[model samples]
Target chain A: MSTHARPRIGEQHCQECLVSIGPERIREEFPTLWTKVHGKPLVYLDNAATTQKPRSVIEALTRYYTEENSNVHRGVHLLSQVATQAYESGRTKVRQFVNAAHDREIIFTRGTTEGINLVAQTYGRRALRAGDEVLISAMEHHSNIVPWQMICEEKGAALKVIPMNDAGELLLEEYRRLLTDRTKLVAVTHVSNALGTVNPIQDVIALAHGRGIPVLVDGAQAVSHMPVDVRELDCDFYAFSGHKLFGPTGIGILYGKAYLLEAMPPYQGGGDMISAVTFEKTIYNTLPYKFEAGTPHIAGVIGLAAAIEYVERVGRNQIAAYEADLLAYGTEILTAVPGLRLIGTARDKAGVLSFVLDGIHAHDVGTILDLEGVAVRAGHHCAMPVMKRFGLPATARASLAFYNTRADLDALAKGLHKVREVFA
Target chain B: MSDLRELYQQVILDHYKRPRNFKKLDGATRQAEGNNPLCGDQITVYLHMDGDLIRDISFEGAGCAISQSAASLMTTVLKGKTKAEAGALFEKFHEMVTGGENAVDPMELGKLAVFCGVKEFPVRVKCASLPWHTMRAALEGQNGSVSTE
Candidate 1:
């Protein structure tokens, strides 16, 4: 309960100290991890799909619904005022979390997919002209790709993909070549969900900015694993989901630069987004409110703030170091399994291990792993382009999180052994 | 491991390892592609029919053990059966995998009974039935593609 008492994670001496406290302390906070599945202890490795919520986040949801459950923005009464204050404070927490320049730059959304679609429809629809190109990467999730595709198709713009190497790292040289005068916007993922390749987003942003192109980052997989500073990266827009960060589902944040968001049209027209209304001409609300239409997910925002606080308390630097060590151990152990070929081998990777067994389909591998109480995602992972790049129909993915330990990876290895045995 | 063993019986594994009639028909009267987008499993069924009777049936595809074995076993039982019989078989097979009430008798299913274990895994029902769905599509002259969404 006392986070301040722990040694500062980045200090040289505290690395071992955090290691000593280890995942046991962290795992205790997540109640679901302790549960059994298929008569065995659950080895939950599907973090990239969605993370397990900690007690603090769960309790935050409970607290919100039990006490401060009221509509936000328009309420003039005491409960409404309290709910509005809490909701706005959640926005401020998000601003601080991503280190956005202003609170008004943070827009509450229905997860990362909605956030990407918002910018693609509003900013992309406006800026794109005939024959213009919107550059995205090959490793992008379907969420990032499809929105741009829809907007581009509508605006008579073509979607250009920045190709990746065999190891799943983006080809920066090819990316540089793709950026040109005709390119209107750049959308890319900070970390690939399927491959776990931690993209060089700083370099990506710089290359796009050099061409005077605005960049939007899909940080759904990055926010929980590493510290993100929107100002430091200089990305014009960054979107992330709360569920992926151990918070409740149906809520996320889209951080855009103030000027860009001000210029863009509203994504949806509903109650909270309007300031003054008339049948003839209605005036829109200002800044973030202009984007967040209808009644917001008040409890999800509160829970997301709690999840952010929980992650901050654990220290992202320490979590990164711990997960890196675990990844190395995982890579070694998983490679030792005969016929297990890893799909992504990027030098700078975090949070996922996607692979395919020699003679086993990923669907079969998944069913076998589930029997051993090791949960993993097995499919194209909504990144069919990446699947086609490797000439694979599907790959079994075991994604990581800060709460996971070497023991969990060991269980995954054991499960793969069972998979091989079944196939043999 | 009882449930696992039941689901992945030796017979099913054998069929998956060496599928029978796993070839494309050169002069096929009917064909249909089946896709299970959830698992990326795809199968193309080819049939050579003569006057409402299946003279030769085969499948060419790649997928999991359940799906591959199901397709392999299906081709074995369906040869020479009438189009109406194939339709009835599809219903019975669907009911078997879904564990519906009054599930078809295992003895009646013959080799196809091995797939009865598929009922335990609801998510995989599509994998076990993809080939059958594709086969049904081929029979109906629905030539394009079918998806078990």
Candidate 2:
């Protein structure tokens, strides 16, 4: 009889665990066993949906409510002064995070949805004329598409869509052909939430600028994954959600050029966003305040600043490198599954893997995976045009973040095998 | 290992795999297309009626298991029934799928009883109800471009 040697426990470990193995080690080392004392450690593969809040961000929220809890820009007490300073400091941090030129150019709103709506109502309704064209890509989320449609309908302007290939990459040739003298604005996503394709925004912005057309890049999915320099890209408008970037919900930033913002009308009429309010007429406040209507999410803004600081401390480049490595590994393992077809395979991609099995519904696959405690997003992912172009009803998408491990990929692969078995 | 067994019960899977009257009629009176954009599920329902009675009913499209099965079961049940009866049956099925307390007519529902399991999954309820909604739109004499968000 041949005897096989038994390996010792904890002999092999991940490099990331070796580097940052303080409390996180205790969390990951015995996930199931530790759930008795600590709560269940959720294997969150739904980063594309929303990210898990880190300890620093949670602490920041608690600290702000405990220490500097007061309304900003209204009161005249010591606590109010500290609160106002903290709020301004949060704005400055946002300006630096995206490398914006001026702090006044950043406007805080409810989220990316509200930001897009603000641009549509203010800039789009005012500038676009009859027969003017507003260009958007086929892979846009409903938030990016519906706002433009609403404004175009009211302004009597035409809405044109840039076609995308099967790989989910925007057809640059078709995009160039669509750009005409009547093209007023081109709105595109910086990164696709469904396909994970990172669009080449610099080239897209330059192309739009050549035609004297402004561009709005939806950075809701891209800001947390990669470094975004608004000045370097020279996009006229950029919007992102704080919750998607490891911060709290109900807060987002819209970065716009100072000249265009000044040229546009105010989005809403309110108390704080007014220079003077008379019975006959009202004068709007300066640059960003004209767009911000009411009281904002103060705790959310402070938490977002802390999230940005955490990202900077960990280094965006290092995080991107680790994510790239994980994507490569995940692709290799997922492709090995029999009768599995990946939906989007663009060369320039993020850490998203969307696929469909030969004989199973995406919902069935999702249900089976959920039983194994591995969460993933299924269905069109709010991109119906992309699904129509690809001849698919729905797809299962597995999006990865920097905190994901190779073990997570293995678990996903194992769950996929069970899906195949169920459908075989 | 059959998808019909795991997701759908035996009756619904059988109806989906070999659907009854699953073809376009020579002269269809009422036709409508229903879409569920959230899942990219689309179906075009055709009804050939004589007076108030449904002579033949059919559907043609590609969708998920729940949708296809629901379409198949709906066409089978409505083929020989009157338009009023079909509309009443639609209400019953809708009630059952949406978890309402209204009593379901089991004979009218037939194989569609398997789809009652979908009520537990809120997202799949739209898939199962697409065919009924499309039929309602066609009977109301509307143009065939109905969407369930």
Q: Which candidate has the highest DockQ of all?
A: 1
User: Where is model 1 chain A poorest over a 10-residue stretch in terms of lDDT?
Assistant: A6-15
lDDT of 1 by residue, B1-149 (tens): 77788899999999999999999987889999999988888899999999899999999999899999999999999999999999988999999999999768877788899998899999999999999999999999985899998
- The sequence of per-residue lDDT tens digits that candidate 2 reaches over residues A1-424 is 1022432112232223322533344233223322321122345577888876665677788888998899888889998888888888999999999999998999998899898999998999888999998999989998999999999998899999999888889999899999999999999999999889999889899999998899999999898888999999999999999998888999999999999999999888886799888899988899777887877788999999988876665556666777788889989999999989998898888879999988677876776676566788888888877787888888999997766788888989998998775544
lDDT, candidate 1, A291-342, per-residue tens? 9889999999999998888777777787788889989999999999999999
Q: Which ranges in model 2 have alpha carbons more than 4 Å from their true place?
A: A1-42, A177-180, B1-7, B27-32, B48-55, B77-92, B102-111, B135-149
Query: CA shift at B49, candidate 1, in angstroms?
Result: 1.4
TM-score of 1: 0.97
